[model samples]
Target: MNAYTLLPFIVLIAAMFLMTRSAKKKQQQAANMRNEMQPGSGVRTIGGMYATVKEVNEDTVLLDAGPGVDLLFAKNAIGAVLTDEEYNRIVHGIEHDLKSDAGLVPDDASSLTESDESDGSAAATADDKIDLGKKDSAEHGADAIQAAEDKAAAAEAKAEDESKKTDGDSDAK
Candidate 1:
């Protein structure tokens, strides 16, 4: 075999190894992003759906895709998250566009008012309500309380019934 021919084969192997490594790294980065997704986060899906996260499971996420349209997708299908700054920019830009379109404010000059501030506060409050904080802890506490109460009630009922039964048996005897 010519030395030149062997050189090409070595180069091909090296290229394949590099490509594989790059793909692996990409997947790891994607996995990390998916894991970081939380409810109320803004994300765009691979399928071109953009929405705020409504729920996040180990492998899937539920999104409110506007107009009462809810969507469910694999966590891996999430394409990108809008950073806090990016999200604010987009929201403000959209608000401005909508106001301009509606002729609600003059294009020459405008200022956000007290109502706007209140509206923004309300929106943030809505977001806080949507955020599922410490779900596991809340669920566990509720379940434990419910179970303990249930067990105590059942035990008390059982004791009462047993006492009545014994009294009835003695009276009959």
Candidate 2:
């Protein structure tokens, strides 16, 4: 009957209203995305299957799952649509990372090699050969872990030395 009693109910109603409004906005955005689906677009399904849009129906979509594979799915099953740039990045980024990890230089950097500048010949040096394919993934991972541990140990030793110096300074003071 007073402001004190009505305050909790008012706060609860405001929270519920805000939540409903957010849900409605999300639903509208999803509807807009679905309506904008066109053929040749890349989409990932809710089941985590990546496919290309082959055709679009009122409530269903035809997807190409690569290599002459085609399947139909509900329109609502699509999770997100990818742009052309995103699709190319996903496909080629892994290859680029793998090449870099294998100790190979990019084709454009001519000063790093002497075999051929115009032909993009990557003549492997002794260091590159030693680091190339001599070890398995497990061995490489172990080496990386060991290097990190050595750096951490060095840092800890330095920190301890600084702390001891500080303590000695305080004692002298």
Candidate 3:
């Protein structure tokens, strides 16, 4: 076989090798992080709960979920060990989104009720009518078609009378 015939197999082997290498690197990092866990450290669980590490066992961890509440979790369940600043920012909401909150619009519908005036009368006085933007015609033009229908009916009646007169005279001619 030509060299090109083996190119696809080589590419497949290289891709699999790279993927496994990266996965092993991540596993090593996670193991190192888990082994370095100590009491009083902040940790996020795989379940997304943030807590302080109360105790670190060989195969398990004790997390302080809240005041007077400690929960036991597997070592693998600890997703990440956060820094003191990031932990306080996330768990206690300290220094979190304060600047963004100043310019943010309210989540509730209370802002929609406000208008130019502050006495609560501006909303009602703004526009009482819902205008369709159509001007009224002097003559509505609806009767334009009605008049044609009436004229057609009148001509039909006259033609029926003319047919009665023509029937008797046609045989005589």
The TM-score leader among the candidates is: 2
Backbone clash pairs for candidate 1 read none
Model 3 lDDT per residue over 1-173, tens place = 99999999999999999999999999999999999999999999999999999999989999999999999999999999998889999999776657777887789865765676777686775556655886445565667668889999999999999877756667988
Instruction: Give the clashing pairs for model 2.
Output: none
lDDT of each: 0.78, 0.83, 0.89
Per-candidate count of clashing residue pairs (backbone under 3 Å):
0, 0, 0
lDDT of 1 by residue, 1-173 (tens): 89998998999999999999999999999888889888888887888766888999877899988879998898888998877556655654444244456646655432442245654765555446454565566659988888899999999999999877755567778
Q: RMSD to native for every prediction?
A: 22.8, 17.4, 11.4
lDDT of 2 by residue, 147-169 (tens): 99999999999999987775556
The TM-score, computed over Cα atoms with residue i paired to residue i, of candidate 2 is 0.57
Task: Please state the error at residue 77 of candidate 1 in Å.
Answer: 1.6
lDDT score at residue 41, model 3, on the 0-100 scale: 93
